[model samples]
Target: MKVSSMDESGKYDKANERLAQVKEEVGKVMVGQEDVIEQVLISILCDGNILLESNPGMGKTKMISTISKVLGLEFSRIQNTPDLMPSDITGTHIVDESADTTDFVFQKGPIFANMILADEINRATPKTQSALLEAMQEKQVTVGNNSYSLDDPFFLMATQNPIEQEGTYPLPEAQRDRFMMKVELDYPSLEEENKIVDRFTSELDFEPELENVISRSSLIRLQEFTRKVPIANDLREKAVNIASATREKEELDYGASPRASMNIVLASKARALIEGRNHVSEKDIKEVAKPVLRHRIGLSFQAEKQGMNEDKIIDQIIEQQ
Candidate 1:
């Protein structure tokens, strides 16, 4: 429901409180990276996939698994490697020999769960990587003749090690566009690292008992509410213009598509909701623009030689808008 009246405003406040609880619960197991956590939540609220890039041992898997537990969603993990096959992600039909006769039964893969963590996704082959396209876009998998629908509230978070490129196959542009955001996980600060060391090393098996902050139905309702958050006309126009300017810039060889524009606005709306605001703001758009557009745009050789990165280029585009 839209938050147009005072009654609806109270509902919005209550949802925000619950979402805050979700963050707090996640913080128990996770350290810093507050922005990263917020972006992941925003992507979930939009019902979109995520591409996480970071160095090894950055707690990407731990962060995702913890969020799944706190949200009361089923979580599955797939470790992608060079030998990983398409059937490994999407289930294959197996022969089941029962008492009466032998029959083919479909075994669902990890993709059937509510939250999936695809670790080291770039390590998989191109063919294997392409297998995720149908599921990410359509939320279903086609084996031979029959298609199986995935569970509701399905979310995929694929992580790739940015420092390694030896045996990795970079994701194609089409597949990258399917992700709503490409969140970069950076190294924690000195204090945050100290806290991480104490939190994990102090206990033998430091597994914090995280309570279910948001139930399944509550999460689904929050996803619906995220779309109802309002944005001003000027801010919406600015979001569009920021995306459009990417195409016109000479520093970039390729620009983002209309999907980038749509994601920018949608992500801004979700960010507003997460920040306990009923209306989208310019700061929200600016904050979400980098992650939304970073992976979608390509830089020219000159820009690369000039030591310019996607985030830097995106910042320039935002300023122009």
Candidate 2:
């Protein structure tokens, strides 16, 4: 079903309302880090993957799991480790000895689901990581000579431990580029923490139930609607200028690529729709810029010595913009 801005005006407005309801449904389970939740949704709206970095017990897994349930999407999780293999990540081919079969059979891995949680993803070797990465980028898996397309609306949300570096393989630039956003989750405030403790330490100690907010067809339609959201010429230039500045500055050794510019504009459009608007604005660009570009840029040795990083550099660039 093709949905366009010209097709129907109410369709866009209705989708925006549904997207807002998704936020409310997810909030029932997630405590703090509203920004993190928003960014994850923004990534989903853009049909992109995200790398979530945070400390232990920050509710990273729980949040995503709850979100999957709320969205009524098929969810699968793989705890990535050094011993993991590519065949283990994607589906593997096995010999079928049962029945009258004497041929090789393919067993689909967890990657076939609508949403995937690659837990501790950095622990896996590059080869194993690529299995997931390829599926993320191509939306399909190849084993032997056959290829299998993943379910529609496939989404990958991976988690990484920030403090643990031992035995962990850092994702290369190309692999990192596959992720459109790197969302860093933070600890909750005092009041939020108090609520967390009270909520979890209760006598019941039961998980909250999340409703399936929308259908798969609705999600696809919304993704289409996101692309059709209009952006002013000035806002588009601002996005480009910020992305270009990343490469032009000498303070950083590496900078965001052209993909970053594309993601920023796309993410900005998604954010505008989430805000119940049909068009992109400068505020939308700034709101989505940091998380969208932070992981794409690289920092220089001098910047490292001065305690400058992607976040700081992005801030500087945005300030200049």
Candidate 3:
């Protein structure tokens, strides 16, 4: 973790090289969303869930699926809908009949995978959404008095459309807090959009063959190394101060919890490792602040009336710190 020795330095360098390869592999299918890809990688390294916000047809699913393949992790997707039941995602027990006897058997659901893409997550009713709560936080599923452990390196990336609100159930505050970071994917730039169109239209079936850049065990080790990334005492304090400032700000009705503070520091460490750095910096904290605090904090009526948003409030807090 220290990387002071030549062997540790070599491992650190190899990790970054493989991570860059992962981005390159994902970039083949995904047009241009470097920031989005990096955020997802950071969440994975931290072993935390992500809440992704974007409009439809933005390749959110493709991005996640492609990354799963490149990282060599098991991928499963759940298309959330109002009628989707808890059993649909978490599986249910069924009666198994044999020649002489019948017994109940436990079946596994899509949540057993290493990476789960919960598409259009807001479309699911609160009851169905709550079903994911235990799995997301505990990495285990409970079915009929039995608990089953999820695979290693498990994380859920849930997506919601920002343009649509009707007939959609907003994620409750508790569920939203379960996500380590809430990432907003904007529309691609003109150049990127053109590339996207040309890339898909040119071929009858467009599928970019991507290599497995990192294996499951290596990924697990990298996640452990992410935590070992060092940070200066002052930078660590700065991260805490930024989270604490949210509660003190008058423009917000309620601020982020202590969990937010922990996420900021952990995420910063992950970011530093991703950037091929040995230590965390102020820039790392500032870069991750908005995504870490946006969904956790609420704006006051006055702030909302003034057209102020969570990002703006977060920026002010960072400036103060």
Name the 10 consecutive residues with the lowest summed lDDT in model 3: 1-10
* lDDT (Cα, tens digit) per residue for candidate 3, span 236-289: 899989998999999999999989999999999988888988789889999999
Off by over 4 Å in 2: 1-9, 203-205
* Candidate 2 positional error at 130, Å: 1.7
For candidate 2, lDDT tens digit of each residue in 1-321? 346545566766787788878889888877778888888999998999999998778998988898888888999999998999888778788889887869888899988899999998989988898887678899999888888999999999999887356778888888889999999988899999999888888857657777789888878878888998999998899999999999988887788899999999999999888888878988998888888888888788888898887888888899998
Please report how far candidate 1 places residue 14 from its true position, in Å.
0.7
Q: For candidate 3, give the lDDT.
A: 0.92
Sort order, lDDT high to low: 1, 3, 2
Expressed as tens digits, the lDDT of each residue in 182-220 for candidate 1 is 999999999999999999999899998899988888889
TM-score-sorted candidate list, best first: 1, 3, 2
Alpha-carbon lDDT, every model = 0.92, 0.87, 0.92
